[model samples]
Target chain A: MAINPLPPGAGTAIGIDGLIALLAKLPGLGPRSARRAVLQLIKKRESLMQPLARALAEVADSIRICSTCGNVDVQDPCAICRDPKRDAGLICVVEDVSDLWALDRAGLFRGRYHVLGGTLSALDGIGPDDLNIGPLVDRVRKGDIREVILALNATVDGQTTAHYITDRLGALNVDVTALAHGLPVGGELDYLDDGTLAAAMKARRKF
Target chain B: MAINPLPPGAGTAIGIDGLIALLAKLPGLGPRSARRAVLQLIKKRESLMQPLARALAEVADSIRICSTCGNVDVQDPCAICRDPKRDAGLICVVEDVSDLWALDRAGLFRGRYHVLGGTLSALDGIGPDDLNIGPLVDRVRKGDIREVILALNATVDGQTTAHYITDRLGALNVDVTALAHGLPVGGELDYLDDGTLAAAMKARRKF
Candidate 1:
């Protein structure tokens, strides 16, 4: 059985298998599907592959977490953090960068963002230090921010994180609110469609 | 409208936006999800992005379709085609390479494969000629191939494709057997778990 072996330095050096493996590491892609994607990308290289390569290289070179909010950005302070037009008085806190994207898609939330990086999880040993809570507290202490919206997932870890952030912000006198009970139990903000997110945001109640 | 003009040349020269756009072109990923993926890949570039980029390039350079079986491969005939242990006399007809992978995972049929590339669809103008049927017929006539398994999906289009191949193979005087009806209606072989697949093959009936 003269089965063709994978070429030397194939995946490690970057090849089809490497591409499939990399794509598989994404949130939803798997090995089999990643293979198909690699095939498709190859088939559409002129239109897709070269552009993708350049994009991959550029992101690899430039992307970094904003020191203030932990949002991935090309600049030191992300656009939202630096924009004076955005509502600095209101800070919207979220679990991940994806959550921020979901809120951005809704085209609401004129306020700036505070990405917590992740929720508190005793099971996973994630604590306040693991998250970007220090910068958030500093922003609150500056006295420009009057409200902090905890747009966290309704999971146990998410709620725990929300409560923890609330406690950290306790010394500051500010209105703390959360998205209302309209969010289905354990539903991720990313899974909620634009209309549902809009509704939940509109009906937010005091935490 | 103060979007910082997307930072000049970032619109098309390649970066997060371009990567997100390419990802969004995939079957299930959308622009919002694509952005999230790009971010994730950037964070894990050493383990993910670099390898993926290499794979993308290799596939872009080396991959193509098997002229005989329609399986996507690095070579013209594909690895399965050159495998001597596989029973060339028994041909398993499938809708696509994905189906071939499903059958391989089950490790049932030690036979060879003939990928139709796609199903027969009158509305979409797909017909037998559009598939690998002619080449399959040619192979059957040349080889000592005996049983041909119809492992196509249970969808109308899948059935239609199977029947088209069957009708074409009528003159070839070979036994044409189809996968069992135990497969749920409107079932796709890829979605079925391993046990069901094994059971289906064990109970496969005549066409």
Candidate 2:
């Protein structure tokens, strides 16, 4: 039998095999999608492949963690932390940089952000030390931050982390607040779970 | 509004924005997944992002089209075409390199391949002259090939291209054959379409 009778990577170019292997490790991309992507990328070398390679290189070289909030960016403190117009007095706490991105996508949050990096997970052995809860407490104590909003997900780990942070900042004199639980914007009563319906009813506002 | 009140790609590092845009352009990777992938890439910079960047750059720099088979690799003849063990007398023609990869994945076909690049599409203005059909005919004419297998998709354009190629190679004295159409392996009979069921019944073998 020939060297590559089993398909790619086995007999393909070293560069292609390496690229496919790395691409497959990405969040949503599997081995099959990675192979297809490599083919398309090579086909569109000038238009997409070269540019993507350059971008990846530049990002890998320049990307840095924000010492202030655990956010990843090219700069030290990050853009959000450096922005003068943003309300530094109000800080929104989140579990990950993805959460920060999600909240920022709404364009409604005007305050600065504090990325916890992760939440409390007993099963995974993650605790307060593994998170950035210490830095958050320090920021609240040192700065004029009046309120700290917990915008974590509704998951058990997320809520547990939120509560843990709330308790940690209780002595810091900062008004710790959590996001209001309610039915989603397009969520129907019939489709919503009992927890969501109860929370929506409990937080119901009068017209 | 602040520089990046609307989220990423606006003021969040030019490298990151460029990476996300290019990643989102890939198949199956949308804007949301792209952002998440970037975040993960940055987080796992040393192991994933840096290595991925190097891999991308290497692939972009070294990748080349197989002059003989239209397969994209780091070599002109491609690994499959250059393999001495492969049966050069038998050629499997496919619409694209993706099809070539799919066929090779089965590891059953021990022959060379001819990538047409794309199928004949009158609607899209794609014709025999636009594809690698000329090169394929030349390869068959010059080489001592005895059989040509049309492994094109079952789509209208695919079948049309297959017919056109068959007519072109009719006088070449090569035995032209197409893949047998039948119900796919692991496909349930109940889920099989009418056309597939009919083909399966008609192509049934001796018990």
Candidate 3:
């Protein structure tokens, strides 16, 4: 792979190019943004970059995926799983750690989370056995769980995975629910697709 | 300062909050994007995160601002400053290291660089002494400099700084020149400002 997008003279110094390359691979950063980021980091070496580097090192050294819920954390069970304050009976299932983080950021969900890693994708050769479905089923079957919130994406694969999980948890006497489809806050009706608009219209309540 | 924009439970994990906070401060990365980047890093811990962490640490430990020209590099004088092949008598003055890097990336400038750190901004209380103008003048006065290219931004402050630098180098026998102003390549005339269009018209060459 073309790791360094920057030309030879632009980053002739060792590790600078490497750092930029790695940063570019991040979610919201491209080559141009990565270059800018690296420059900013270098400029504020003492104040920002050093601290960030230390934090990254520390996180890389300590972080682990929770074997039970698949949440990324320092602890094995993760903070949510370990938290006695959270509702252990309720589990909110998400497709990835990012989704779990997003829900956690909202601060409304007082329940535990189950990260599925990804949805069922026949094209990608991913199935139930590949995901955290087995563990989720195991958790649900153990009978302490009162509900399983299927907070998966609205994509075909996501819905498919959710349906499969719902089927698996059918034997258990647990309440299964998915996230309500609605027009997003600050979202314009004209911008929304037919599927989302239809779903939102169908799920509309007397508000 | 509120470093982390994410709610409490979103990053309750050990060192994870700190990492997210740090990542959020980076250019092109907000709290949401930072969280996503952090999750990605965690997911690809061994392949991406660890290597990035190591590279960041290494760069932070070794990188230094070149005392001679203020360019960032692993060495004190920097590779560009120490390079024997580059034209020692010609110096390109840029407002920031990023500008210098951009020029270097083009691979056309065989001359050395002089990073001004920033432009002269009286409102911001930045003066000639705040920039590397003194060092640049000193470099010229000490002899060998045949030309000084002012590759500063097209902003008012940038122009003012360039003029100030030119004034400072008045006593020296150095040929000073600013970058030519024109409509950028692939830039639409309608999208361009009046000043750029006028400049481009005035500087138009026979095809």
Candidate 4:
């Protein structure tokens, strides 16, 4: 993780350094990669960077969180919540908006989503109140949701949050389930951990 | 590469899919990473994305190439070319603006620069006239320049362009030099090719 040696007032000019600094903070980019990206953008300013800048502005201006499901979109209820074809009775709960986007990219789930923002982290002082668990329970209590799928990550905090949500929804008549734990597609058995292997073995299905 | 399965009118919201598609075309980003970046941007719209949009607009509006050195900057002459501290007798010739940016990041060279835009690639129909070679030669022929350092890449085209420039500047009194060819710092010997090894041996110096 080498820091960008070029400071603000160095040989590099103007907003270019600032853009690189901001781009470097992205999830998959470091300073070097950010510099490369910025150069590429500057070189293809008309074709790429300008369009991206415009698109970013448009998205920034239009995007908002769905009041119903907590998903970010251009509309209040979001496209997913507004879609008439998706199953409103099936709500998929995820830790963050990124998780929702990932599932959407998979194109497998045809249900609405509930973004919890983050899992219940006792160490980090994140409780059920800090998340969207209350709203999710309220959605279930409205008698529209038939199934509440806990599609959170297979982490300690994720599981704890799921359990807490289940407890909160204990009085509801809806069924609750979780994503199946098993070897991922194209995954090798040798690379799997003990917990995953145990869970896979316990839940083994007949072919 | 896995194509993004999410189509234009799929469950994903409007403008978001387009943004992801455009972002995926960047140098180092893939569809998955682009999706993650977009989600992150949307998540921190007020703090990060909005500011990025503003900075991008500002840069796009202000950035232009310097007439003398071809360096991209907010000013016409560019800050470097207008600086009175730098050496006017030395000029570093590079293939593209990105190369000039790389050298500027190094912060070692006090001389100005000449961006050739591209090498003399016969395969791609690029020739001496297509690049900024004529202007470079004109600048050298003016007799103020004492040295022209060829800071092009180690590629075959780069070397060919360097040779062509050398020939073009032959009638002038300016001295032409190139970056030294040797093993890069922190490079593993076993991983190096025979050409690099030979070059390193031929240019060996007593420590």
Give TM per candidate.
0.70, 0.93, 0.91, 0.91
Better of 2 and 4 by lDDT: 2
Tens-place lDDT digits, model 3, residues B5-109: 443445454489889889999989998899889888987888898898888888888887888999988766777887768999999999998898899899999
Q: Kindly report which residue pairs in candidate 4 clash with one another.
A: none
Q: Tell me the deviation in Å of residue B200 in model 3.
A: 2.2
Q: Give candidate 3 regions above 4 Å deviation.
A: A1-11, A185-191, A204-207, B1-13
Give DockQ for candidates 1 onward, in order.
Answer: 0.28, 0.56, 0.51, 0.43
Write model 1 residue lDDT over B55-82, tens digit each, in one string: 6666777776777787766665666776
Go through the candidates in order and give the clash count of each: 6, 0, 0, 0
* Candidate 4 lDDT over residue span A91-137, tens digit each: 99999988997898789999899999999998999987888888898
Best by TM-score: 2
- Please give the distance, in angstroms, between residue B52's alpha carbon in candidate 1 and its true position after superposition: 2.7
Model 1 residue A129 lDDT score:
91
Name model 2 segments beyond 4 Å from true. Answer: A1-13, B1-13
For candidate 3, the C-alpha RMSD (Å) to the true structure equals: 5.5
User: Predictions ranked by TM-score, top down?
Assistant: 2, 4, 3, 1
Q: Rate residue A12 of model 2 by lDDT.
A: 63
Question: Which residue pairs show backbone clashes in model 2?
Answer: none
